[model samples]
Target: MSFEKENIPSGVGGNMADVKKSGYLKKLKTMRKKFFVLRGESSTGPARLEYYDNEKKFRTGSLTKRTIYLRSCFNINRKSDGKNKCALALYTRDDCFAMVADDEETLSEWLQALLEQQQAGLDGAPVPAFGKCLSSQLSTYGKLWWKPKGLGSSKNLSGNYRLCLTSTTINLVKMNCENEDWEFSVSQITSNVGMCCMCNTCI
Candidate 1:
């Protein structure tokens, strides 16, 4: 990305390298301005609603956290009559902000932009990739079935079963059966001592 020295305000005086080191250049390159956006609303009414750009660089003010690194956001559903209005849930580590957009398309644009910024901010960080954080699962069909949670008796509980692992729980699906799939929380399960790292333990 090209950095414009003129774009930097007076107080933020320095060469491009200094600005980059301060992490201001990244924010400036991804700034987005939206119209009719409301900030901090409530059930009875909006607390402090206005069209504002948190990403904007000002000559005389401290930058808010949202302006620096907007991490993630989720969509809020409104009634059919509220079609033109779109609400979003914006979040940081210790803080969250609610925003309203004029329409779905506009909300989509902002969501994409903020997510891109979040990805960009973490591009060179020494953090694990998103895929590594997820748990691996295996599926197999065999004669080893079990009942779901809250079932006490294990008597005669063998049948065609399918086992799968998830990030949080283990799922046991009864093949060709109408019963609900059994789910075991990963915490409730234990692994044997000296287990191989290559094989994932099931609950």
Candidate 2:
């Protein structure tokens, strides 16, 4: 309910005040906004939610405005108690953005829609074609720049690798490899940060 400086970046821990407090609403002066939420089509490709600046721009069919990729979203929440119960917040890796609903009932509907969309992102997106792993469902896949510890400025030992994820093991394969020399396994890992591992280490 309290107004924040718009477009300000929040931490990874998320802006807790957006979820818990609305005490300073009366003292803060905020700008008026006219926004339209737009949804992307369902697909394995990158899922997204866009908000147009205004109604006329949206009706004119301009689809390239402010966009939030669901894959990067880490949290979603709606106000549990407040003078205005229509505030909903979306927290991504770097920002916390909020939207207001017409009423509490309308807020519930919007929350449900957002929950489903956010959940869909958790299932995975933009699956790559790994010729031999058809039986296993992909969680996420992307190229990673891997530089091993204890190696000081070693260009030969550090290079780009494709990290693939499935139901079980994380497969790290070199972009150009002829044998198993470049393929890495769990056994090779010595240690990792606990929180960085996430809820499930596997896909």
Candidate 3:
């Protein structure tokens, strides 16, 4: 359930697969505490954050699949929508962390910085990606029966697909294994042919 690490090399027969955190494993990989310093626009001086643990500890290195698509799922909420705008909330899968900035302007700056970083992450995807990871946040995803244009009615195109849509891209992932996927960019779309983009579902 954690990041994949290098397995210990055995002489010949390695029974380490069944062993969970054995003494021999501890000698090779020792747990450690890492320190992080946060520099924000607030005048409250630099903040020091530390993560110390054994099982679910954070590590520094290349971005994983979860981190790459983090913005697509994670949400940043402003605590107060009316008056007090200095507080911001970061949401995880099961936890919400709130922090107060020095002032409203600082809070705005922090929010802008986080949004920029999320967008920049899309542009910085590593080559030979684990798979086809999206560079932008996915706004909508759903499965539907797609109909291709032809002489007959909409009943002929029986291709089932899952549509993935972002701000700039539209992708169709095939259902089962019969049809191939099709992807299109916003710029590639042409409206000169009226009623070109039509949708119909299979009964």
Candidate 4:
């Protein structure tokens, strides 16, 4: 017996939306400029190293201005990081890309172009772009204990602290009349595989 049905539910297929077509749409808007010695860092490979298209068949990735945040390489402290000096950085929340040009002049030109696009996007000018809003989302919270150094083992058993996880940082407060408050970066958290942050003798 053939039980498979071709038709779907009313609410399921009606709400479907079209995917982003920014990729090919952007290429058509910008005109090809005749420039000499235009070099850019490869998206994949060593950090800030000189990149060349060793293979004849190579395609460079393009960025949409609204999705990325741009910063001049000079603004970033790259001394200990081993990043190239003559470079421009473009990043989103999840990914980062650094491009290096031949000279300072070339790098400046690239930076200027990126900034111009960014400003245009901010001004509400139409450009092929994609981005997300993070401000409206709510943060999750959980009960956790914070034990001070030199505190006795008996104090750890009380479980008096409540930790609130925010978008950027962790807000911890002692659940008592004092209402002691503490805030720290989410990156400072260290945890085990099976175990959570709540328990006796938590750091």
> Which number leads on lDDT?
2
Number of colliding residue pairs in model 2: 0
Weakest lDDT window of 10 consecutive positions for candidate 1: 1-10
By TM-score, the candidates rank as 2, 1, 3, 4
lDDT of 2 by residue, 1-203 (tens): 11112332222432222221111111011323544343433431334455445555544555434556544443456633354567765544234456666667766776666666655555644422232222233334445555543331332434554445445545544445423223223443335343233222221
List the candidate 1 regions with Cα displacement exceeding 4 Å: 1-68, 71-85, 128-203
For TM-score, the strongest prediction is: 2
Clashes of each: 0, 0, 0, 0
Candidate 4 lDDT, 1-203, residue by residue in tens: 11111222212222112111111111111322211112222232111111122211112322212222221111211111144556444422222344555556766665554544344323443221112111113344335554433231423423455444556665544544232445556565443222233344322
lDDT of 3: 0.36
Query: Which model, 1 or 4, shows the larger lDDT?
Result: 1
**lDDT winner, 3 or 4:** 3
Superposed by TM-score, candidate 4 places the C-alpha of residue 130 at a distance from the truth, in angstroms, of 14
**C-alpha lDDT of residue 70 in model 4:** 25
Instruction: Report lDDT (CA) for all predictions.
Output: 0.33, 0.43, 0.36, 0.31
How close is each model in CA RMSD to the real structure?
17.3, 13.9, 14.8, 17.7
Q: In model 4, what lDDT does residue 66 have?
A: 24
The reply for model 2, stretches above 4 Å from the true place, is 1-31, 41-45, 63-65, 80-83, 125-203
Each candidate's TM vs. the true structure?
0.32, 0.42, 0.30, 0.28
By TM-score, the better pick of 3 and 4 is 3
Candidate 4: residue 190 lDDT (0-100) = 40
> Candidate 1 at 9: error in angstroms?
7.2
| Candidate 4 wrongly placed segments (more than 4 Å) | 1-83, 125-203
